[model samples]
Target: MARDPNEPMPDGSGCALQEPFALQVLGADMEPEFPDKCVVIIEPTEFCRSGMYVFAEVEGVRWFRQYLRDEQGRERLVALNDIFPAIELNGLDWKVLGVIIQRNIRRKIKTYEYADGPSNQPHGSINAVDITAS
Candidate 1:
């Protein structure tokens, strides 16, 4: 997909030197974690800190999951949903498409589709995706 030449990325992120990736969201598999209809900005060059929300491609599928590293010094990918779908580093070669740097959400009282979307709503905060690099 082509971004408008005048369109600006958050924090002065530019598309000139970077190849922008566009992926259609499938469903609520990653909600409370990310807004349902919001466009996810996957910043590949940004340093992915532990606990940061990340966009990854695994087994030919693209998804947004919390980049997790357990105490064993292992890199793992986990879904925020209670189901907690986990991807271990042993066999699956997870590709970090980029880090979820920004999201656009539209709601009157703020409702999320992930585990963190809203408490009254609990299922967590749509803006609760952790981005702090380790």
Candidate 2:
């Protein structure tokens, strides 16, 4: 993993571990998805990739959307769920936050068995199983 150019040492007291950036989503800009207050994670040396979520800083505003690459490898950050707003010329000085690995929702998923019931059961499915937990 790449470390940030400027980061203080972490002691028992505490450490500024991961770099997190907060973005205030606006207007159908990224609607249908990437709602407002979508906290994005930005890791050091993590460049932008087409069709990936990135926190792009343009002018004085920051935007979160799925980045798209053109034939020439040029990029345009676009929202999959929205089309009214389109981002163009994606090579500008944009701060790329880490890709959105998951989403936050209030809905609960129903399953037949508890998570530990079966290995192939859906109810008790576990993501990123811990070595210690197993």
Candidate 3:
């Protein structure tokens, strides 16, 4: 694929570098864990482990998948959804752009609560604010 000279290439072949950015998940390739429209935080310099979620570029195409090693000790990309076939990376030119640190699943309302300790809350009751109620 042709890349714009002004825009930085994700392959790291160009001098331009990219910073941390947000990418919205699409399709069922990474369903359940990374549902559709869920925003993922990508840190360009984050270290990627064997089982960590990563943003990788393969064959000039970008994808969100789990990084894993195959039985033959070869690196491969596995989709959370079993329906999608895993990509064996024996001959592909791939680059790990970043590791996904966090994800924001959109819900009705975001809530949180603070308490002194576990004793401050009632048994089997959550201390979180119910601001969703109007």
Model 3 Cα lDDT, one tens digit per residue, 1-134: 87678985566554335566778888888887678887777777535556667899999999888877544788888898899998998888888888776666764332322223234221212233334445
Best-performing candidate as measured by lDDT = 3
Question: Which has the better TM-score: candidate 1, or candidate 3?
Answer: 3
Please report the TM-score between candidate 2 and the true structure: 0.50
**Every model's TM-score:** 0.57, 0.50, 0.64
Off by over 4 Å in 2: 1-27, 35-45, 107-134
TM for candidate 1 is 0.57
Comparison by TM-score, 1 against 2, better one: 1
Candidate 1 ranges with C-alpha deviation above 4 Å? 1-24, 107-134
> When superposed on Cα atoms, how far off is each prediction in RMSD?
10.1, 11.3, 10.5
lDDT per residue, candidate 2, 1-134, as tens digits? 97675985554223343444433444555544445444333432256545555666666676666666655767676765655566776556665545444343232221111123234422123342112221
Ranking by TM-score: 3, 1, 2
How would you encode candidate 1's per-residue C-alpha lDDT over 45-74 as one tens digit per residue?
Answer: 533545666787778886687766555778
Ranked by lDDT, the better of candidates 2 and 3 is: 3
